[model samples]
Target chain A: MKKKKSSIADKIFVACNTLFMIAFVVITLYPVLNTLAISFNDGIDAVRGGIYLVPRKFTLENYQTVLGKQNMMTGAYITLLRTIIGTVFALVSNALLAFIVSRKRFLFKSQLSLFWVITMYVNGGMIPVFLLYRNLHLTGTFWVYVVPGAVSAFNMLVLRTYMQGLPDSLEESAQLDGAGYWTVFSKIISPLCKPVYATVALFVAVYQWNSWFDAMLYNRMKSEYTTLQYELMKLLSSVMQQSGSAANAAAAGATASAVTPVSVRAAATIATMLPIICLYPFLQRYFVAGLTIGGVKE
Target chain B: MARNTKTNAPAVKITWKEVKRQKFLLFWAAVFVIYGVIFYYLPLGGWIMAFQNYKPKDGFLHSKFVGFDKFIFLFQDDTFLKVLRNTLGMGILNLVSTFIMAIVFAILLNEVRSKIGKKAVQTISYLPHFLSWIIVTGILHDALSTSGIVNEVLMKLNIIDKEVNFFAHPGFFWPIVAFANCWKETGWNAIIYLAAITSIDPCLYEAASIDGAGRWAKIRYITLPGIKPTIMILLLMNVGNVLNAGFEVQYLLGNGLIKSVSDTIDIYVLTWGISQNDYSLGTAAGIFKSVVSIILIVIANYMAKRAGEERLF
Candidate 1:
């Protein structure tokens, strides 16, 4: 009798759990899908509201307006350039530093490790870093996106941990073959560390792709260097500030009446999100592995 | 690390010959160390501006020194206090909401019987975590606009008489920030707990079931206890980060109407240090925040040590 009651309770529990999970998935996904729908909807029609999962008056004018702008094109170009260049620069530098510290025979290994570890806990905060950037003449340059962030202490430590796990025999054999540290690092360790390198590469790439603050802070005056995310931010903020009864007034002053700020903002947002959405499947695999590995330590 | 160095330093001799043997490695190491010093250590030198009436023209050397007056002024200022309160308020709200939601989601996710269903839900859930805060905030604005779906639902349910402009209210700011943080981070944060849960001994669950424990009983007795160490460690780590409520969300989502509840330490620093050109005061405020962060982290580490949980250090 007790077993029968317990089984019935378990069935009800499973039903409720399934319903909860379904709700969770819906809540997580509905916003993105709704945004997609709004982006395709006619701007003036959308202002009437009630557009949910599908467009009320479907149109491609929003995307056309967003993509036709010179700044938007430039922003996309810069974002792509930064993501590619920044990821490579950060990965190589971090791997090199990790290789140096991972060497067991190196006298400065512990000191080097300690040096990098301290950086993770303490920083000079924002103003000091901003001042330092100004002093270095890095405030207005493209290198501001690439160079200052080239070697993160956390990524370096993650790479070092992976390298430390590699057997000493690999390096010894390479050394026996007249290969120096660079050759061993470039030819041997780097190839062997491909899995971790992929993880770190994806991490850096996503960060570079998504970064807008650096552009806003350092290169705000340089319109040419603005990133896609920053451009979307500008559009979104303007729309949000004037979103109520004044939205149409602002829209009439802009380009065509077909593309309101809301619709254009949605279109730009979807455009900005395109790369991430395309890469998310691969990102999910590596990041899950990366988090489990990096999260285990400080 | 300090202990290891003290014991090993006396045993190793610094000789020119030993250094020369690893000249190539030493050369690269020296280059990186210099790079680290310039980029990392050099910034700390600018902290001295906190004590001076800093001027860009006079540089760090010739600035008129004011001791702790800037810091004193900060504490006495009403705006600074409000900013502090806002930062703490938003930070604690985000921490609690994200922390609890992640754990609860992980537990519920683990209970799903279908492997494919579990994987799909998790993959979809993590979609928001990868997007930039700008995109998240943009979506948030659209959803909470007076004519948006939230108001639509509330009206359909007859919860309110008419559409409510959610962001215009001062009281809703913290909760909105907390909800945004949960929406973006809960899924990503749950990954760790999910990993923890999977590692738990299946034997324990089997034993509990044989003892006539229901699903909730087993979860309470076995699963929750299994992941408690992770929960504690993550909580302590988050406690150390209670000041970092985040800047982009507040700065992007905020308007004049919500300024009192929205201004954070980062915004305060940006306004004074960068916009207002009061570098000394900004540096002083920045210094205060950093000092408090380090103190909180130390306290958290001490508590972890006392509690015999894993210490971050």
Candidate 2:
């Protein structure tokens, strides 16, 4: 009788837990769905503001308005270029640093490791860094986004920990065959380090893709060097400021009468969000694996 | 020659032979070390600006020495003090809410018995985390707008008589920032806790059940204790970041009406340093933030050591 009572209690708990989980999922997804609905809704109608899961009067003009903007195309190209270049540069730099430090017999291994780790703790704050970039003539150029961020102390540590786990025999055999440090690193350690490479790549790519502060701070005048996220930021902020005014609807440059700040902002937001959403399914496993690998306390 | 350096001798002298033997590796390492100095350490030289009555036209070398003046001005300024308060208030609120929500979500998700259901829910939870703050704040503004779903629902449910302009109220600013953080990060932050919980041995649960402990009893005794170390470690890490209330959400969502409660130290630095071109004052404020962060980290590390918990340092 006691066992049956416990079983009934377990059933009740499971039912409640299931309901909670369902609610959690709905709450997590509802905002994105609502945005999609509003983007599809006719802009002026959307301002009347009852749209939730479905558009009141469906239209595709908002997307056309967003996609047709010349600045959006320029921004997209810049964002893509930076992500590709930044990830490759950061990976190579961090991996080389990790390889150098990971060597068991290197004379300055511990010293070099300590040097980089100290950087993780504290450094010059923003104004100084900005001034330094200006001194180096990095500001107002595309290289500002790519060069200064080439080395990450955290990613280097993550890569180094992975490299240190490999058997010593791997490198010993490579050295026995007249391969120098470069050959051994490229031919042996790197291929073995693919999993970690993927993790660090995803991390750098996401950072580069999402970053807009650099453009806003350094290249605000250099419209040619703007990023997609910066463009989206500009769109969102402009919309937010004049949200009540119908003047922005015409300013958005859409021939369609339905184009309003609400619709344009929604469409631009979805445009910026699409790549991340699409790639998430495939990349989620790597990031989860990456986080677990990174979560291990040093 | 590598053998000489590898050996743990009482006195090891530098020799050209050893340097030559490892020349290839040494060369590249030196290049990166120089890169580190130029990028990481060189900027630190710019901190001198804080001690000077700095003018960009005068450059670092020509600026007049005015020790502590910028810092004194910062403390005396009412705006700086208010920004400090907003930073701490929102930072603490975000820290507590996000941390607790992540733990709760992890525990609740772990309670689900169906494998597919758990995976699906976890996947969906992490979706918002991948989004940029720009997107997240845009969605938030729309939802909290006077005619948005929140007001619509509240009015429909008869919870309130009319719409509340959430962003306009000083009292609502902190909670809005905290809620935005929780919404964006709860699932992502829970990943670590869930990983910690899963690492707990299943035998603990089995043993507890055999002892006639109920579900809540098992969780209370076993699960919570199992993840305590992780909780402590994460809490310690977050304590060091208590002042970093983040600039993105505040800058994106904040308005002139809510500026008093909305500005953080970072935003203050940007406005004064970059926008206003008061480099010395900005650098002083920035230095203050960096110093406080280091001190907090050191204190948290020391306390963790005293408590016999694992520390970050």
Candidate 3:
């Protein structure tokens, strides 16, 4: 009788869990869906009232305006190039460094680990980094974005930890076959570390794709090379400026309507986010696995 | 005995020769050393600017080094004081709320039995993390505006008489920012805690059940304690970055009306350094933040070590 009652309670628990999970999914996805709906909605209608869960008057005008601009196209291309180059460079360097550091027989293994950890906790902040870039004559170049953030300490540590967990017997066998360190690492270890490599690559790629702060800070007078996020920021700023100016004009007896400004900003946001969002499903499994592996140590 | 002696001598010499032979390791080490020296240690010298009347023209070598003058200025300036308070306040709020939510979420997730259900929930939750803050801020703008969903619902429920401009009000700004951060990060952060929880032996819960412990009791005793070390280590590491209340969200959300509460040392440095071209003062502020971060990390690590917990060192 007690067992039967507990089964009933367990069923109730499972039902509750399902309901809660559905609610969470809704809460998490609602904003993203709303933005997409607003981007498609007529700008004038979107700004006037609450339109949640669906688009009232569907229109592609806002998207047209966003994509029609020459600057947005160029900015998208720049961001794409940066993400590709930066991810590739970061992956190679981080993987190589991590492989070397993970070798148990390597002299100064602990020392090197300590060195990387110190970098994680301490750093010269923005100004000195800026000055360093300036002195190196990389201020206005594309290299500025790719080079400075090329090797993340967090990614390196995760990669190193993962590599350390790999079986030592495989490496020993490779060495017995007269393979050198480089050959053994490249052939034997690199193949085994695919999941982690993919994880770090995704991380670096996402970071590069989403980053606008550095572009804003370091790329002054280089507006031609603005990333997508930076372009979205500029779009939002201009929309605000236009609204403020329109209000001023209205006060001075001018009849100017800025109905679609918010819609256009929404469109820009959707455009900026679409690439990463599209990539998420492909990487979702690895991302979870990677987090589990990397996080287990901590 | 003679054969053993000869072999031992050659073996020792071969190991010594192998050490000399491995020049590639030394080469890479040197490269890393140079990278560290130039990037890490050299910039540390910039921290000296915090104590000086830093002028770009005077440079570090020629600058008049005043002792703790800028730090004193920081204390005296009402704006700086307010920002410091805001940083601490928001830091604590975010840390506590996010920590609790993540732990709860992880525990709940662990109870899930259906594989597809778990996968679906994890997939949905993790999706938000990939969205940039720019996109997140845009979402916030649309959802929290005067005529936004939040206000509309509140008004319909008679929670308020009028529409509330959430972004404009200083009192609501920090909470809104914190909530947005939690919304975006809580799912991703919970993955770690969940991993820690799942690694707990299933037998422990079984044993607890045999002892007549309820589900709640098991969670309280077993799950919570299992994840405590991970929690402590994360907390210790997070203390160093408490001041990094994030720049993008605040910069995007803040306006002149709420600037008093929203301006962090980072935004302050940006304004002074790049906008006004006062590089020295900007560098000084940045250096101050860095030093404080380092000190916090060291102190936290020391405390952890003393408490017999896992230390970063």
Candidate with the greatest DockQ versus the true structure: 1
Task: Give the best candidate by TM-score.
Answer: 1
Give the alpha carbon lDDT tens digit for every residue of B1-313 in model 1.
1112222323345588868767777898898888888888888888999999999999989999999999999999999999999998899889899999999999999988788999999998888888999999999988888887888889999999888998889999899999999899888899989989999999888778778888899889999999998898888777868887658889998889999999999999999998998988888888888888889889988998999987777
Give the distance in Å from residue A246's predicted Cα in candidate 1 to where it truly belongs.
6.6
Model 1's CAPRI class is medium
lDDT of 3 at B148: 72
lDDT of each: 0.86, 0.86, 0.76
Instruction: Calculate DockQ per candidate and list them.
Output: 0.55, 0.51, 0.43
What does candidate 2's lDDT look like per residue over A135-217, in tens digits? 89999999999999999887888888778778989998988988888998999999999988998998899889888999999
Single-chain TM-score of chain A, each candidate = 0.93, 0.92, 0.87
Worst 10 residues of 2 chain B by lDDT: B1-10
Q: How many backbone clashes does candidate 1 have?
A: 0
Clashing pairs in 1: none
Residue B20 miss distance in model 3 (angstroms) = 4.6
**RMSD in Å for all candidates:** 2.8, 3.7, 5.5
Q: How would you encode candidate 2's per-residue C-alpha lDDT over B195-221 as one tens digit per residue?
A: 889999998887777788888887789
Interface RMSD of each: 3.8, 5.5, 7.9
Q: Report the C-alpha lDDT of model 3 over B92-130, residue by residue, as the tens digit.
A: 788787778777777888778778878778777877788
Model 3, residue A77: distance off in Å is: 0.8
| TM-score of structure candidate 1 | 0.95
Model 3 clash tally, residue pairs: 0
Candidate 2, pairs of clashing residues: none
